[model samples]
Target: MKNRSVLVSGASIAGPTLAYWLSRYGFDVTVVERAPALRPGGQAVDFKGAVHRTVLERMGVYDEICRRSTGATDMVLVDAHGNERARISGDFTGGDVEILRGDLAAILYEAGAGHCAYRFGDSISTLRETEGGIEVEFENGPAGNFDLVFGADGIHSRVRRLAFGPDEHFVRHRGYYYAIAGEPPHREQSDGPRRRESYAHNDAGRLAVGSGAKAQQMYLFAAPEMHFTDEAEKRRVLTEKFTGMGWQVPEMLAELPVLDDFYLDALARVRMPSYVAGRVALVGDSAYGNTLAGFGTGLAVVGAYVLAGELAASEGEHIVAFARYDRIMRRYAKVGLGSSPGPFLAPKTTYGLWLRDRFLGSRWFGLMEKFAGDAKDDLDLSGYPAWEAR
Candidate 1:
């Protein structure tokens, strides 16, 4: 058994998943989360290629994930008065099984809890590199030393700031920003499941899609680098941008204050020179967060698997493990992030939006899908011992 200790920051999707694999490899893993408990209310995230499914299958949670999947594979684009403009099917949208992000996180946490130590409502305050390990100071807990530390915290990673530098140096904003929140669909039926309508305002460039009991309200717009310090200011901007819009926009705004999972961020990608430094390394979004490209979740899981496998293969030598992890994921991440459709999703001009809608409504979209093929990720999972054993 590998006796080295590992500290992973952020108990979200990546951190918990990484902890799971590391624990399986006999590493003493600890996951620290800033939130008090497991957070809920994120849209469905799915697996695409064989590589992603292989990792999930190895984790032994694939069946459970499929069972809990939202099964919302098709979406229709509608105008202000709830009329369908264009329809996108399962092939273009959902890859295979699509489960809610929160549900997936819960599954990973449950699987890892027995083997990995969990610290909630706490965060790393400071990190100092020692001769043999990294010394960490917690915001709410006592200081400790771990053989290695990882920053699996999302794009706005605190560990990145402490170890690397500010986020501005790494994140590249792709000319737009988006906000999403789960809210009750308008005009519900109590007899059975609500017959929800996925509406999109072509002129407004906003969308409202069905997601369980509450639907997800999507607000996307093109902007040139603006800053809002607090949530109040962010909400104010959202209100200003979407006040007089149509198709449930008014209702979603009304429910925004009460919604627990209101998340907003720039539709950006992280571009780091390197993902490691000494005993500290980064996984998932901290290293490669291609927001709105629909590949973040899969990348997180695969990255976690590779990081743990490399550690186990290297026998707790972080220097070798980190280098191999970087070498394997760097090109994969580059290709993935390069293919992000952020700019195409939310075009700047009204003409661009009209063009986008026209394509969606036309045969071009279908033709593109036919050529898309099932082969996206190309990572060789067999090389890793963890995956091979499974």
Candidate 2:
């Protein structure tokens, strides 16, 4: 892969992770992000299953993740009345380990700190695959030629839009509209819905709190089966949905007027027939993303592995590596994002959510625990050619 240049879109999880591995495997890598810089904390992401661990270990960040992880011990299911229904320990949750999404992104960025070219505050405006190589022009004004390009630019990827026609063709609506913003307050806001007294293993269990940070904090809001085309539409729908939902919601909505980092969108997934399209390939959420599936992290880590390993195995030949990258990554993404167990976790309908809480939480709790205990067993990370480059 010497002298072969690659431009990965979005410096989020997958792009940085892939950049480190590709750089290690002898590919010149550059990651571009629309964000001005590595975004600060907003949401918490979990890492479950053995593959997550394997990838982190390989990247040499597993210990760091555990070190900086939010040890959320117990999860209490409460109703609109704040009445507790059931309690689920973090262990019973396969991906129980949770961390601020920004922290994880920071760890990934650190991995390629020096080796990879990081161009922040910009993104790919256009990508053209020519006879000799792919000619790429960036919004930040960088022009270059790359043997191949990968899009890890999250759910709404420009590369995917440009490479694979309009997003409507590949985006499968998952029948839900999710949104998260911080709760506005005076000062000293409590952590929203704490799993226990302390975030650590508190079996005795106490009520969770709100964000105990400074007031005017970011909060989260989600509505189901809403309509929206873009960011403004999403905000309007959110405003319409929670106009009367009480419990400081009005205050949260009031903050919405000034909220800049509002993550509002219909819960959706990309159901591409295949990830590979010409010399451009899609990775992470751009390829397979089922927000309801709860495998965004898994799909991302696995995709990085496939992309790097395939490139190394194929030497510098973009064709062979690109093809094999598609072969391995598509299957992993399918299993991780299209699995059955996920919708049960974040069901869209009342009935489906009831099934999860009642059947899984009540009478079948023991069975569910057993399955969760063995959740990592289904992962088959075999046949991946380990590349120790000469």
Per-model TM against the reference: 0.90, 0.82
Tens digits of per-residue lDDT for model 2, 1-390: 443788889887889988988888888888888888998765566777677777787788888777666555454555445455555665554265666678789998997868998888888888888887789998876688887788999887899998898888988666545565553222112443234321111111111223333222322233345555788876776677656543344555666766665676666878888887888888888888776355687678778877777777777677787887777666556554554332544454556555665764565777755664355335465645357433
Each model's backbone clash number: 0, 20
Task: Give model 2's TM-score versus the native structure.
Answer: 0.82
Off by over 4 Å in 1: 1-3, 183-197, 204-214, 361-375, 385-390
Q: Residue 262's C-alpha lDDT in candidate 1?
A: 72
lDDT for every model? Answer: 0.78, 0.67
| lDDT agreement of model 1 with the native | 0.78
RMSD of candidates 1 onward, in order: 3.4, 5.7
Clashing pairs in 1: none
**Alpha carbon lDDT at 100, candidate 2:** 66
Instruction: Give the Å shift of residue 357 in candidate 1.
Output: 2.4
Per-residue CA lDDT of model 1 for 1-390, tens digit only, reads: 343798999888889989999888878899999999998657768777778888888889898887676664566766778777666675566777777788789998998899989999999999999887889999999999998899999998999999999989998887778888764233212342222335555453444443333456777776677888988888788777777878766777787776656777787889898999988889898999988777788889999989988988888877788999999899777645765565566555678767877888788887766544333567787778544353
**Most accurate candidate by TM-score:** 1
**Candidate 2 lDDT (Cα, 0 to 1):** 0.67
